[model samples]
Structure formats: C-alpha cells, structure tokens
Target: MVSLRKVPGAHQHPNLPGKVKVEEDVNSKAVPVDQETMPTIIQTVKEDLGELKKFYNITLSPTRFQKVEHYLEKKLEELSNITFGKLNQAGQVDYALLNNYLKSSLQRLRSDKVKDDEVLKLVGSFAFIIIELFEARQRIQKLDFQEVAALFTRADNSARDLKQAISSGIFRGKIERTIAYRTAYKLEELSSVLRDWHNFYLGYEPLYSWWVSQPYATFQENLSILIACIQTDLVGFDDSVKDPIIGEPIGRDGILADLDFEKIAYSPEELIHIGEMEYQWCEVEAKKASCEMGYGSDWRKALEHVKNMYVGPGQQIYGIHDLAIEATNYVKDHDLVTVPEIAETWRMLMISPERQKANPFFLGGNTMQVSYPTDKMSHEDKLMSMRGNSIPLSRSTVFHELIPGHHLQFHMIKRHRPYRRIFDTPFWMEGWALYWEFILWDKGFPGTPENRIGMLFWRMHRCARIIFSIKFHLGEMTPQECIDFLVDKVGHERATATGEVRRSFNGDYSPLYQAGYMLGALQLYALRAEVLQSGQMTEKEFHDKVLHENEMPIEVLRALVRNFPIDPDFRPSWKFYEKN
Candidate 1:
C-alpha cells in the first residue's frame, strides 16, 4: 500500500529561527537569537537596504544592473506584500537569501554576458517562482487528498510555464542554466508527490483524472520532452545530474576534481582500491571489538552481538533523547568544538515510517529525526529496522547528527551572512559529520575495542558509499549491484541497503552527495593538516572559522581560509589531495 505521507514545506529546520508547520506538534519554544544588535542592523536594512542595493550594483554592470534592479525590486515588493510580516528569524534569513539570489542572477547574467532578454527574463522568473512556491506551501494546511492535490497542482502548473523555457538551452559550460533545471527538479518532486497522492487516495480526489485531462497533461508533456532532450544533450538518463562535488558537471575526471583529488586523480580501479582498504581495516577492528565483548575475533559474531543488544525482543530498548544527552556530554567534554547555547535547545523527533523508505537512517537539519520503524510491517522488517540501527553501529553518528553536525550548522548559517547558504553542498553537510568520527577516533573517543569497532564501521561505510555512488554516476554499476555491494561488503541488512540505494538515485539527492561524506571529510582533513595540525589554528579555531564561513565547496573554502583571491572565474585549483 502506498503510504499517505505528503511533502511538507522544504523542511523548516527546527534550530533555525523560523516558523514551521509540521505533521505533528513541534516545540513551541522560540528559536533563540542574539538580537541585541541585530534589531538595529535589521532595521537599517529595512530602512533603505542600501547595503544590499550596493551589492546589486557591484554584482552586475552599472549599465545592465539598473534594469535587473527594476525587474526584481517590483517582484520582491509583490511577495513582501503577501508574506513579509510572517517571517520568523529563519524567514528573515531566507529573505536575505532571496536578496542574494536576485543579485546572483544579475551576476550570472553579467558573467555569461548573454544579452538574450528572453533567456534572462525566463531564468529570472525561476528565482521568483522558487521564492513564491515556498511561501505558498508554507501557507497550506494538511487535510484530505482533494485539498492537498488542488493546492499543489496550482503550484505546479503555475511553475511549469516559467521552467519550460530553459529546457533545451542548458549547454555545457553554462553553469547558471542549471538554475532552471534545478527548479524543474523541484517541480518534478511536487508532481511525484501528487502522483503518490493520486494512488494513496484511490480515486477519492475528483480532480485526479481532471488534472491529467487539462493542466497537468500539458505541463507533463512539456516536462517529458524537455527532460528527454536534456538527457540526450546534457546528462544521461541513468546517470547523475550536472553538479559534481565542487559545482560543475561530473565528467569522467570530474569526480576527482570536485573532491580536490584531481591533481593525482585516481582511476576507477584505484578509487575502488581505497574503499577495499578501508573495509578491510574496519573488519580487523571489528574483530578486536568482538574480543573485548567476549564474543571472539569473528566480525559477524560481533555484529550479531551488537544487533542483539539494540533490538533485544522486538522493541527498541534505546531512546534517542537519551542518546542525544549522552552525545551532548561527550562533545562538550572533548572540546572538539564549542557547543553553542542554542544547540542545547535543539529538539529531536521520530521519523514516520512512510518517510523512512528513502531515509533508512537518521535525518538531521535544524531539527533532528531519529529513525525507528512506525508502520505495520512483517517480522523481518521489524528486525531489520532495529538491527540496522543497532546502538554500536549508530553511536558514531549520534552527536554528528546533532551538536557539531547540522543543528549547529543551521544556527551558524542563519546568523552569519545567510546569503552564503546558496553555496551549500552535501560535501559540507554530510562531510562535517563524517569528519567528527575521524576526530573522535583520533582523540580516543572510542573507549573500548567495541566502541572503536562501532566508529570504524561507519568510516568504512562512508568509504564504500563514495565507491558505489561514483561508479553509478560513471555508468559502471546498476542500482541492484549497489545494493548488493552494501549488503555484502558493508554488512548492511538487505532491506536497509535497498533503501540506501533508492535515496541516492532519487531526485532529492545529487550525485556528489553520497560521495560527499567521505570525500568531503578527506577535503577537510587535508585542510586540517595545512591549518590545524600545522598549528595555524587550534581545533576549536579551525572549526569555528568553517562554521562561520557557512557551507560551500571545499576548494572555495580553502581559498577563503587561506585568504586567497577569488573572482567569478574562480576554478578549482586547490588540489588538496595531490599525493594520494
């Protein structure tokens, strides 16, 4: 049966200063902010927005920028008329982000130097529709199939016309054309949601067929033809999307380039070798953990023992709240990074089963969702849900999902420039969490041999993820083969492995994301050797700088940290992993 889960507004991250609408009640506690001086600053921006207007001019040539300002300013005013007063701190941050978005459009237009007004206006429409779509969705209430489908269809067809313009114009080397493509990707996401709603409601939504006959029919036809053209012209059908780890297409050599591993770019075979090496190292550590647990030096036995402790007798014996508390103590005690005051107030909730098919593990952002099963399922699924999330296997990432991982990231990004959130990639989001595992393991955060095994298992899993995802993008592996590799090599439960692969291929994730965890960690680690290990900055100082810089590709980050000059023509030249 299709689960009746609907996509909510682009997840309103709990930690950020924002108003949220959730499927269930959330903490009513206001998101904390250091508003002492911010009110004055915000007021100043509100008064004239001189600072933003100055950037608008700087981004675009004085000659061409005036028209952009004239176009965008009118549209922003219309949106502000509708949703201005309702903004929470998070909402204010998004508003600032939208300002950056407008400025960026002009900057991109200037850089591309494309004088085609039609293309410029169409691309410009994407930025506005994106802002409006989020605002409209936030105003919606979850109810029946009829109301939900109606609400989203209106959102869809309205967006479809604006997006169809760039469907065929996405040529190679034109990076900004992806603005339209990514916007279309979001449209497809909504369409998929409606399709699922069509199935879940089972003819109850009267307009289901009605939509296909008129608006949706036209929208979808255009979408299909465009995607087919894009596939033939740009990225392939069964291949990854355009953006690689850094920010361009992941050509055969592009993955290494994106990861800053291009200076000595490894061949596919060598890349796979790195994964195998990590897997073997973890297996050896797992045996030691088994010995410490009195289970003998058999990895399978150690896994069995860990799995049993977590599942026990069909009920989850562990509480995620308790886990968060334990993680809080460990992170603070170690002083790896200062746990900010707002982090203590970050909340946790359970992920619904309908949502878990794509995310078998935990999902974290401003608010953290601890994964466990909630649906009516067979005995085997129940066991897989429990065993796959066994305490030892899950521990290394608990604090990672919360403290120094996403919640803190969400908090920092909002308070910092807020505009830089555009540069975020999975490399930074997922990589930082993975990097902490390295830091903890180095600092003896793993107390016993078993704890070490637990931590090392996650590291091995990240390495395997890079190998599988990159090969899939290179068109060398099938999804089934990816699943089998995870089950056989990473010791994932079969069902869990399937979910993992599904999430990777789904439109929600980019090609670089799965690789981002390990590859991104390596990027951060290499920089650490240059900075932290080299005594240019303490661990706290280095981490603080990264957090404040907000999330961007690591190559760009390296330049920022080193105070190297960059411009619109900035290319990935850091090559952090030259030797290995």
Candidate 2:
C-alpha cells in the first residue's frame, strides 16, 4: 500500500503572515512580522501555490494556477477578519470558512481555465480537507459517554452523505474524470495515514491488541461498543439490482467471455461450494452460541426472539421449519445458479472473529461482522456467551458486505485499469453493492415465497434507511422521531432504531445508498436494453463488457455505450433511458 506524507502544520503555508528568523543574540527562532513586511505574505502565498500547481502538473497551462491564486488571495483577504482563535477554538476548524476558501479558489480557476478536470480535482482535494475538519468536530462532540457510543455510527452515516453529495453534484463528471487520473496517488496517501493511525491508536497485529491492552475496561468497552455499532450500522445496505446472468449456475457464456474468470485464479463452482460449507458452519456456531446463552431449550425459540427483536413489521423472517421446504421449492421452480459463488465467498471470508475485529467501520450493532454467518442460524454464541438475546438482524449481511456486493464491486473496479476512478468514487462503489441484493434473488437463489419475503424484508430495511436519512438530515424530523419512524415503519427493535438515530446525528451520508442503488440499477437496465437491441451484443457480451469496464458514473457508462459500434439493423436510440 502507498502512503501519503503528512501534511505540514498550518504555519507551514508560506502565505501566512510571519517568517521564522534566527536570532543569534537571543539564541531563538522567532517569527518576524510587522506591517511593513506583511504585504509579502500575499506574494509568498501566490508563489507557494504556483509551486504546488507546477509540482502536480495540474494543467499544461499556468493560466489555471494564476486564476486559483487570485481567488485564494481574495479569500485570505476576506478571512483577515476571522481570527485563528475564533476559527480553530470553536473546538473544530470552521467548515464555513474552509468552504468559502475552496469556493473562491475553484471559481477563480474556472474563470481562467475551462478544463473541468483540473478544477474538479483541486476542488475535491480541498473538499476532502474540509470534510476531515467537520469529522474532527464530530469526533470531539462525542467525548462524553453518551456520545461515544454514537460516534462510529455517525461517522458511517456521514461518509455516506459526503459520498452522495459528491456523486450527484454538477461537479461529478469532472471529478470522476479527474479522479480516474489520480486515484492511485490519493490511495497511497490514505494508506500511509491509515497505517499511522493503526500503529499509534489501534496497535498492529493480533487484532485489537491495543484496545484489549488498555488498563481500563471502560475504554475497552467503549472501543468495543463503537466497533459493534459501526459493524451493525454501516457495512451493508446497497439497493441496486444484480445482473441475473452473472449469478447463473452454469455461468453464462457472456460472463466467461467478458471475464477471464479462469484468470481470476479461482473456480466459480468451488467458490460457491466453499461458501455453502461456510454458511453451514456459521449456522452451527450460531446455534451453539444461542444454546450456551440460554435463549431457550431449542434453537427455534432463540431464532424467533432474534427475528421479533430486529425485523420490522413489513419484512419476512423465515424460520428453520420453513428452510428445507423453501429451499427445495426454490430449487425446483427457479433457474438456480449451481455455483453458489456469492454464498461461498461470504462463508469463507466471515468465519473468523479476528477478521471481524480488524475492520473499524464494522462497529455498529448489526454490522456484517456479527450478522453474516449467524443470520440464518440460532444465536447460539450469544446464548453461550450469556449475553442479551440480541440476534443480528441482517445476518445474511456478508452477502451484501463482501461477496456479490462490496467485494465484487471493488474487485471488478480493480480489474479494469482505465476505470480505476470507480474505486475512488464512493457513490459507484456503494451503489453497486446495494444494487446486488435484488440481483442475487433474480438469478434464482432465493426463489421460494419464504425466501422472497426474507429478501423483501431486507429491501424494506434499506427503504427505511432512505426515509430516515433524508428526513433526519434535512431537519424534517427530530432524532427521536427518526427512531420512532424506523421502528414503526420498518419494525426495527427499539435498541436498533435508537442506534440508527444516534448514528444519523453524526453524519449525512446514509441517503446515497438508496439513491445510488435505484439510479444505478435503472441505468444498467436501460443500457442493457440499448446494447441488446443494437444487435451488436448478446446479454452475456453486454454484461461482460460493462462489468469488465468497471464502475464508472452512469453518464460515462452511457457515453461508452453510445460509442460502442453496432449493426444498423439492430441499433437503438439512446433516447430510451431517463436521466436522474
């Protein structure tokens, strides 16, 4: 992994009002600044910015940098009245000030250089810092006990909101294009920072060693709670549709042709088989845990309690009694994919508790770390552990979090070199994951009525998430109201609902899952039709091409489709698809 160097301190910005001077007599380094020399700050800022622009080669022309300098200068002038104490002492960096600085800088660049790519990239970098400041403020706000439990939840939601804004804004196109050009560079920077954070705070190796080694149980408990919260809240919630063909048992010719699955260095059938075994293993573990925890004499009671506790009224909860019947019926009625690729992938990845603890983002109550292998089984572990009867609601979470969703989307993006930007764009990554839930069903794994209901239950959860995110962030509802709405509308347990509300307060990113899922699916469906009708491609060919090309913005996808050569006899007008 590439690592980014640490950004210099605030005083390092050459444009600041003072310069360090060595005083031999006093044997001290002092910043010398007086009214007479103050004008130099502006010139220095300009010169420094110029150097940065040149170093990055942001554009072939110096004109873009010149424009940015002009705007930055004006912003600094405006901020002159804004005292550092006032801006930074609010316990956080003032985002309003940061936004003003960014806006001014971007506007100036836009006026001078019409290249959307350069302007958007610079804007994105600036926005990243501003977002970090906002997040830091949020973290500080959670210093108290009550707020600490909610911190991770809030961070997850905030990330979703920030990604959504970036995806939907007018700047998305430019940002996407520019990101494609520089994602690797940025990822390197992020990796370095993450390493430092891990070493300094999380402690390397043995998973949560730092957390466990803490002298105070309160601290450990707090960390554990935060981890649990994030895992439950943020890991899996995509709303996009999967390509039925991709999930087929025999594997479609189109999929084969498009992907060198052969080159993936794994067999699809073997993958699915392993997933099934893992699933069964998880079921056994859950039952053992439940029995030990004493949910009831049998696993059935524990399963029931888990369902009633987490599932909302509108969703379906398939009991063990219905499992065999449903499975047999589904196999008989549906064109089931024999490979079980998704299931296999999830089972292999989620069985280890160590893997669960490594991911900080998976801290929430119902996170994939806790839910995946156990959803379909009794809460045996919880029972054996003698903990509360809180079964993970979205137990099939690994399906959404790892294989056939996030993992798949991420790996697919990495496959195509030119479309690497897709990984950088959270919207594409998240939206694609959400869309896969329905797609898996459509491909025939969950075909019985019971299975369908179970699937619908998951969908309802996502829908509720959408409503909650929009209402909560837009101020249409209070945090309490949000909690009530989730419970009343989605049938979530009070504890889960309350967790969701608390999480919402800390961030604004939850809405993107629904929006992206819905929009991305629509785009894929329409694009598929266009490709098919053009007689230039088969379903397999189109899907192969699309997946192989990676997770570009819908607009970019459309452009690529339009440019794809096709037979005149089969050609279809692009007018069929509606833009969001």
Candidate 3:
C-alpha cells in the first residue's frame, strides 16, 4: 500500500498538523527503556552498503551482482569477527538481523542472476548495447554520436531478429513463455532508459541529437514492436482487456527461498493447509453470523445484505470518520494498546479512480485514503465501489488502517529503535494490524451480526489470500482463479476481487505479503497466549513491549519478548502453529 504523508485535496483536521511530531515521549510508559547496546558497526555496514548500491544501480548486471556479492562476503567476515558474548541482547539481535540480511541478500542476488541470465538470452544483444551506452554515460565518457547511431542501428536490427526468432516457436512451453513475457517488460524498461539517455543531451548537444535521433527513434519503435509481439503472439495478451493480469509464478523452490529470508520455518504447502484450516474456521463463524441474520447457512446472502448497507454517494467520508472514532474509543477504552496522541490525528482523502484499481479500500499510514464512488465512474463501477466500502466492511478496516494499525505503527517505529526499520517485515506490520482485528473480535467489538460477517469477510479473505497467493506462486492457480476464489469463497465484489488479485501478483508486493496478515497475526496471537496466559505480562504490557521492540521478524521479536538467551546466529525455530 502506498503511504500518503500529505495530500493536496485531503480533508485535514484542524487539530492534526500537516507536519507530525515524531520525537520520543520520555514520560510515556508505552515505550520501554533501551537496556541493550546499539550496534554501531551495523550502522556503519548499512551506510557502506548504501554507498555501494548507489553506485551500482543498474539491474541484473553480472558486474553489479559480483561486486555486491563480494561486498556482502566482506561484511559477513566482519560480522563473524564480533564477539557475541560481549554484546548486550539488543546488540545481539542486530547482529542476528544483519547476518540474516547479508545471507538473504546474497542468496537473492544468486537467484536473480539465474533469472536475469534467462532474460538476457531473450533480449541480450540489443539490451547489452543499450546497457553499454548507459554505463559509458555514467562514467562521464564523451559521446561519440556517429558511433552511437551505428550501435542503435545494430540494436534495432537485433530486436527485429529476436522477435522473429521468438515468433518461430523456439520458446513454446509454459516456462519458456513466462520467460518471454518477462523479457518483453525488460525491453520496455530498456526503452525508458534509452529515452532518459537521449533526453539528457537532446537539446543541449545539437550535433549529438542530430546524428543519433533517427537511429534512436528507429530502435525505440523496434523495441515497442518486439514487446507487443511478445505480449500478443507469445503471451496472448489482449490490449482491449481491462487490467489484464499476466503473473509469472516463482514455483515452490522460490517460495521456499522467500520463507527462509523471512525466517518462516513453515513450508509453503503447510502454510496453504493453515490457510485452509483458517478458512474452515471463518466459514463456521460466518455461518453462525448468517443464521443470526436470518439467512441460515447462506452467508453469501448475509454478505449481500451487508454490502447494500453502504452509505449513499458523497456520504462515505462521514461513515469512515465515525468508524475511526469508534475504533479509537474502543481501543483506548479497553486499554488494548498504547495510542500515541499523533496516531489519533490523521487526515482523510479519497482514493482516485485510477489508484482504486490497485487499492480498492482504505490505505493508511499517516493518512487514510477512502475508496469511494466518484462522479466519473460508470453505474456498475459506482455500485461495486460502494458495496466494497460498505459500512460493515469499513468498520473492521478503519482501525486496521488508523489507530493501533499502520498509523500508530508509523509513529511507534520512528520513536523506538528506528534502526531496526531495515529489518521491517510485512509479517510484523500487516500482522499487527490484523492481530488487532482478532483481539477486537474476541472482545466482542463486532456487536452486530452484520459487523461479524464483515469481520469474517476480511478474515476469510486473508485465508484465501494465503491459499491463492501461495498456490499461484506454486503454479497451481492463475490470477483469474485467485480472483474467482475471492469472489466465491470470500464473497468479494468482482471488481474488488480483480483489484486484489491484480495487486497481489502485480510484482509490487512480496509473494508472502497477503499471507503475512493472518500468519503474522497468528504468531502474535500465539505469543499473547503464551505470555498473558502464563501470567508473565499483562495485556497492555505485552502489546507495549512489541511496539517498543520496533520491527523485525515476528519470530525474532518472539525470542526477544520471551527473554530467550540471545545467540549471534539465531534462526527462527518456533513452530507457532500446530496442524491440529
């Protein structure tokens, strides 16, 4: 989700300033005192790595990969030299995090190299020429306009050849076809780089533009044609279609690699099973709510009733505002978690029709953007948008975006152990918000059957997310299948379902992101059970401790909160979920 700090047309509260105050609250009991040493070397390593990455910003270059790999190797050596016993618990935590990041970065670089190699095979001849031009520009080399023109000419011919070769059916299978589609996008990116390089000297250096203009134009056209051919002929993409989702699954091995990076010990198959189990639970709960709504076992009908309970046009803002106020009051009244004064103040805005395609609901961090029907939308789209952001649905989502969700999290991380910001995982971020939903449900926040159905809708959606997202990445489900699953199983509106599926596999979010909500919340729920149930910490203390620790893998936070002995090479081993 895109975080909006300031919006031009946002409805600003007079009390909430444009610039938020993020200073430490010394008198606040919410924040725990830092008793452990700060890892200064980790900061140094971070800066050094930042400098290295800034210089080698090009994507998928072997030279870039090798240089980065070498840099990480040296950092690993430096990390190994640190004496684990000398550091405090916090320092040891940073050490473990850095170690994990270095190892994961290295593994990802290697994996990327394999994929890049395949992509280059499809676009290498022409891409290499453009890459050299950019590299030379980066080095401040004098432009050889005539030679550049010749190079572009060669690239244009090469692109044409490549397109013809691909169209000849050499790349026929699903795997090869997926690679070809990816190659098309890579060509689009290369064209952008070409445009930037051309615009850099187009007007300033007259001779350079005059000599290279025709060739550049020819090559850009050729690249576009090649890209279109790959999409249309090879990938069977139709431009007439709206929001065509062409997702390439990474398969089980890639999913395993991602899980390893996130310190999740569970297998992808096991996670899907967990999703199924959770879905079954939500179904039972939904049926109970449906019966209370006089709809018997047909929760879908109950869901329809809730959807139609949406506020009228131009009235969504008030409903959303009231929901936020209600959630704020509930959390504060219950002493669920420490609510920062700043988190309580947030600006509200309407998501544009364009952005609504990707984010069809509330998007919050510092600001909450409500998705509602606009004057420009068609009749059907207007109705879909209204139903998707209905009062009952917005009830559960408001707090998830504001208050104890992303909004409070933004302020909390800035105030506490901000350096651990690099180790931030969606499991902690999205999971914490979703965890609040679980807490609220248990605390009877959903007083009405409609509200419970609404809550269950999102809960089941998260479950479906885990199932569809994992299955998609495992090559067992397509994007359309995922959308259908959301509509059929979770009772989402079709347009809303399309947007959710599009955003999931649109390459913006991590493969595990959708799964993170429920899985991450479940981890926290389990920890809450372990801590509060055992009488080690009160509810407020447990919640406060998590916020103070800042962001890291929930498993790491688990070890920290449990006061487990810190080790330099700690890996996540807590099997938080049981099959039964």
**Candidate achieving the largest TM-score:** 3
Q: How well does candidate 1 score on lDDT at residue 576?
A: 50
Q: Clashes in each model (backbone N, CA, C under 3 Å)?
A: 1, 44, 0
| Span of ten consecutive residues with least summed lDDT in model 1 | 23-32
lDDT comparing candidate 1 with the true structure: 0.58
- Who wins the lDDT comparison? 3
What is each predicted model's overall lDDT from 0 to 1? 0.58, 0.38, 0.82
Candidate 1: where are CA atoms >4 Å away? 1-277, 291-297, 311-318, 565-568, 578-580
Count backbone clashes in candidate 3: 0
lDDT of 1 by residue, 460-495 (tens): 788889788888777677777888988877778887
Off by over 4 Å in 2: 1-368, 372-396, 501-505, 508-514, 533-536, 564-580
- Ranking the candidates on lDDT from highest down gives 3, 1, 2
Where does candidate 3 have its weakest 10-residue lDDT segment?
19-28
Query: What is candidate 3's lDDT per residue for 309-359, written digit by digit as tens?
Result: 989878999988999999988889999889977667889988999999989
